[model samples]
Target: MNRPGLVASKPKNWSIFQQKMRNFKPQMRPFHLVIVYGILFVVSLFITLYGFITYSMGFEFKKEYNAQNGQIEFNVELQHSISEPVFLYYGLTSFHTNHRRFLASRDEKQLAGKDISEDALKDCDPRISDGIGIHEKYPCGLVAEAIFNDTFSIYSNSSLIKPSTANIYPSYETKLFRCPNDDCSSQRVNVTDPHFINWMRPQPFANFRKLEGVFVDGMPQGVYTVKINENIQGGQQSYQPSLKGSKYFVLSTRQWMGKRSLFIPIFALCISVMCIIVSIFYMCVSRYDQHLKEDYLQRHSMKIVQSSDKRQY
Candidate 1:
């Protein structure tokens, strides 16, 4: 008897569950699907545009080369907007001829610090008052010593002339403006040598200036390297944990990407186009199906009404 009662109660509960399920309706509609497809299409378009822009910009090539007896041609472009004088240190490396191993020099590491400044070189020998001291060693100041020493040589292929030791002391004239209260004064300084300027100069900004020619019998027809030793210490001394300067190296004539890079933008554009086509196809199919259903319903209702009218007549 209890088994029969349990079976009966189970049927009643199942019937009530079935009734609830029959009344439940899903909220998802065709409009919701359309909106989702539109969002996806928009996102894909943006990605395609980004890929195209990046591909158009092209990539920059930077490599490092050890200073050694080799021939190199550099076509460099540099821009300097800052007021400070930038010292460019060039030197020959002591590496094996066939090794071609380019290693950053210890002197380059020392120049890569922020602790060095004009104030630090205040006691530097060969001061402006001392005149141009043509000596083997500078008593003080790394900048002075590096510039004065004939440690490196660059022979121009076009002119077929070697630059004099004194020619390294090149300068340019620029107008500097200072504002005190409402009064403004402008002064021009012969911005040639960094040693002569006494006031605290701002950080030197450099861009590729130009490439004259190659090193005489340097490296083969491959990517070569050149290290730039910057001797300006702009940051505070206390902030620097170690007393080192800044030396940066760049690899030249090296393309960052190959022919495969062109495929990236093409693939992105294809994906975007596919998404648009798919969305449009689905939208058209959905509208067509909706129209067919409405036509069928209208024809069926008309048939039922005609039958009722015939029955009434």
Candidate 2:
């Protein structure tokens, strides 16, 4: 009899051979791991570069009054290397005697008594009782009008002098004179000059005095001197104010070599390198997984075939 789904009376050793392909196994190398490690190395390099170009803008005042510490002293680098000017709004802040001493050191006597009738001393010294006066004493208060030339040389030939310091740079503050008051309690004063650097135009200019109060616009255009009455610490030496009106050299911003902000392009480059490394790592890992899967399937298929042949025999 014939069966619907099977053949009856088949041959003694006949059977159907069904071949099944085992799972594909891939043998991929560990390229992905190498790529990931390479990316990490490059990112570290950028951080180091940013730390190494930045500087502040300001002059190092020889006579510096520290608001925080309540102390005053000379800082040579602050005076010569700084590019910014000293600005004052109001209040009694400390100042180093370097600028004041420059004028006082001109002669054996202070500048309080010099013969200077060139221009109006009214703007130079608000306390002047007679506007123009001379002194035969050791420290005479005086204010003279003068101009400065290039190379920071004092244009005026006045006898005004200052301490012999290596960082001596001509400044407008040298034109200070005696306070025009009769009491002479305040011995030192600065000459107010128009040609000098405008301290108030861009901002409030006066560091010690008041605006429209004294020496507003009464200083000489060049060299001058102002006397100092108070003795130095422990009676060291009384100094004066001496100034010249020539073009002074200022520090440039480019000269400030310090750590600066990072550039945008460099930062972007670092990010790009990281992404590429990650992608490569992923590809390597995927390839390795595929190789393992294929190997397993092939081994299973071989075992199944060998068992079937034995059963048939």
Candidate 3:
């Protein structure tokens, strides 16, 4: 109060801040679309690339052998481009977990194949090979016969199915892929070994949304014979197979399933996109409100000055 001679403190330059915000408001408003599109584009690009890379290499298959139950279980997804063709087949054989017994059994040879046709059916033991057929539209169109050998053995007691036939065992087959090479069209890695464990695990199924959704369990053991044409990718046909047993299950047709696990990345990407959008929106609204406040303050201050000037006159 005593300092008339001293310089009065300068008022804050709120006007400058106001003007800067005013200029920023319009620019910020138009940039919302840019922010949203940029985020979505980036996310889409990432997923697309990931799909391409994984699809080409194929998915992995995993299985766990439960020693407690002596059951081998695995979940599998077989994918082959229409460009590539493959055959899948499954069979139940009288196999034991006892290694010594398995080795000693002279009757452990692979079973001969049976066809549904009378000519083909008549050649085998009818009791074992009945009710098998080749349905053209099946997921794995060709069915192959597998032999049953009860004396077969594995390495441990937990490895064998009890009362062997106590459980209604079913076999399944689905074509995984056709060989890419011209000379090897019918070759299938899965059908080669009676106790086939993948040398490298097959890639996991794509678009998987849940862990349990695609889980499977089974054992593979057998030999496969393939037939292919020199003409790559022409004349696909199904072969009917008759087997000696009634207890087998096979997939009926090739069908599309929603991929599992796609939701994780998709959810992540959506959240990230939302964050970017909200940030931009906040920045815009802040600038707009600031501009409106500044305009009101400027107009009021001018009117007060005019009234003061008039009074002075």
Backbone clash tally (model 3): 35
Cα RMSDs, all models = 19.7, 25.1, 23.4
Q: Estimate candidate 3's alpha-carbon lDDT, on a 0 to 1 scale.
A: 0.33
| lDDT-best of 2 and 3 | 2
Cα lDDT listed for each candidate: 0.37, 0.33, 0.33
Number of the predicted model whose TM-score against the real structure is largest: 1
Model 2 ranges off by over 4 Å: 1-262
Clashes of each: 29, 51, 35
Model 3 alpha-carbon drift over 4 Å, by segment: 1-260
lDDT, residue 23, candidate 3? 48
Cα-based TM-score, every candidate = 0.32, 0.20, 0.24
Best by lDDT: 1
**Cα error, candidate 3, residue 144 (Å):** 21
